[model samples]
Target: MPVPADQAHPLTADVAIVGGGIIGLATAWRLTRAGLSAIVIDPSPGSGASLSAAGMIAPVSEMSYQHGRLFALMRDSAAEYPTFVAALEADAQTDVGYRETETLVCAADPADRQMLADLQHYQQAAGGEVEALTSRAARRLEPALSPSLSGAFHSAGDHQVNPRRITAALQTVLPAIIRRTAVELIETESSSGTAVTGVRLDDGRTITAPVTVLATGMTPTRAPLPDDVPLPLRPIRGEVLRTRLPSGLPPLLEHTIRGIVTGRPIYLVPRADGEIVIGATSREDNREGPSVEGVSQLLRDAQRLVPGIGECELTEVTARARPGTHDDAPYLGTVGTAGRGPISGLIVANGFYRHGILLTPLASRLAAQLVLRELDPPTVPESTDHPATADTDHHHLQTMNPRRIAHPAAENQPQGGRP
Candidate 1:
């Protein structure tokens, strides 16, 4: 007899991913390819931060003075994106809108030129390629740039992707079971709290798994979990606006344009479809209604960078919350101390901040390596134990015989029984 839609059989898999964002879906897809049965749970899988992101794969452009480890990680991830997206597209038989263009950092005022110079110096010191140009030369590359533009630096390695297209493609191609429901994870034993034995749904039904990954973005911050396994994450809200330009709008911007004003960064991303994205204002923990002030602030800054934007059509406006972590880097790898006893099967792939889309490929590979324990070529930082200290010395990498956790098989098992 077929199970009714209202009362379907409890689904079981080798792994269960709690979040359906890019990281979660990527992890699930990798697990499935590795011969592990996997499932992803989320109400809106791709519409979170991934959808709202500008998708800039910029390790050099976005680098700051602090956190060298995070920079190395971003660089490694950016390097892996091209091949990763290729394989993913081949698997899905679809296009992901991967754009391989350079990014330009510009300064609209003379005082801001020093900032661009400082950034160029830092890039050179880090052994990255950057080209410094005067206002005229900068305008030569992007004619739409204002005549008063002081200076610009170009990072040729930086690129972008259409986050919406990638997300939609993944959701369509991934083989894992995807459900639209809220999942609550519960620890079977107090001592092994990090080991998620199973998850309970709203209707009082339970599904168990040997491995459960928490990629629920900020939602897990509100969930009940052991103190040791709690996520030290917060939400940073950002507002963005999109505009449609008339035909032959000068192709004013070739690569992504980022400008610094009042010590804060604002950016304008030009799409192949004549849509320019001008964004964004960062606010701390405030999800209040959108403000005209916020939109005006972005427009003021954008118009300062390129006066032509004043005439563009305001197509859309939206706001989203980005997950931030205590370490300022994403929280990856296994949670809790290993070898204490029965290890908790919970793995964290969250706290990606603004780099989620850019880092998806590397994050997916790392998560898959951790789960499968298999060594494969082109895998950066062979050892997953010391993720923060992984060597970025080599441009290419691989991993070796990872340990695999054994799980109870569901063959001839009763429905609703604990694993």
Candidate 2:
């Protein structure tokens, strides 16, 4: 389905996005609605992390994560999500399956119960709201829950949305999305030195724009950046499976059921369709496809959470490497610059890790704001610690600036600075 070079016409826009995943498409849509011309250069849109994500918009669930600033961003994004989704639905004229239901965190055994209690205390200490419930109380809410539960809590702030539907909705509004791979990035001379001008497609068509966003996840069709900087984006392979419930099957999972089996996190998210998404193995490997052992383990862990899933039909198993950074934080600013980049029109918006689906609203908002020069990059602090430990504020882009090198040592740094 590749477009022939002659058939593809050259175009121009105010903002040109390199990748057409949710991050790129959503940003393009936001810019276009803001009265600026926007175009996305990607062949298959929203088929990346957006498609694999189980859209759990729960900042509350991730309070205990190592990345504190990411938690802040998630919480803030979640707070404004209802309004964002409402406006997006009105504009796109399609339901993205934005469910505002509470997420039930349950325990599987007595030891797990203690862990839940400890987590509750930790959340409470962090000034977060969560209602503790006994096993009986938890089952009263989700009766289909495991009968061997020890304890549970209700995070009222947590919710779920269908990521697939959201991706489709984003694609609906960004009609100028180019279904072609970018063969090269068009960088031009500016006072800031080397800023991206536009993109050159594989078919030899050139689409010029003042700004070009490097939303291209993990793999880039061409090198859009300089060789001096390091992106440090690696493929953290994740295997996710979706199962279809049999006809006349009762509602088994009312809300998103997340549990900590031992130390690993397992989740079973219900979709609007009869399919429930039971994923994912967080493997630190460069493997390409789903492994037999990985898929089996996912099924085992999910069945341990809900035994009824054993009867569900396995609909799909997708294995993809999410763009992961050394610090487990995203790089979000002008590449190879010292924060100020009106002249350097290269904006980075990748390395989202596991929060891609949840961070869409905020990420897209930040992307648009960056394109309009309305917001500045947060400053990344000096630290020997991993990127996740960097103390930075999202509002004060000074400390969390993506332009800084994520890992100074650069273990898996891309060669020649161009991928």
- Tens digit of per-residue lDDT, candidate 2, span 1-419: 22232343558777788887778888888887777777787777888877888888988876674556566677766766787788779988989898877888877777877887887887766666789888788888888787877788889889988888887888777657787888777878756467677888887788888778888886546445665566778888888998878899786777888887665677888876777898778888767889899899888877776888998999899987788887777767655633432236677788887878777776777677667762123222121221222122235243235645743322232211122
Error (Å) of candidate 1 at residue 212 is 0.5
Per-residue lDDT of 156 in model 1: 88
Model 1 off-target regions past 4 Å?
Answer: 1-8, 181-183, 190-194, 220-223, 247-252, 337-342, 374-419
lDDT of 2 at 92: 87
TM-score of 2: 0.87
TM-score of each: 0.84, 0.87
Q: Tell me the whole-model lDDT of each prediction, alpha carbons only.
A: 0.69, 0.73
Q: Which candidate's TM-score is highest?
A: 2
Q: lDDT winner among the candidates?
A: 2
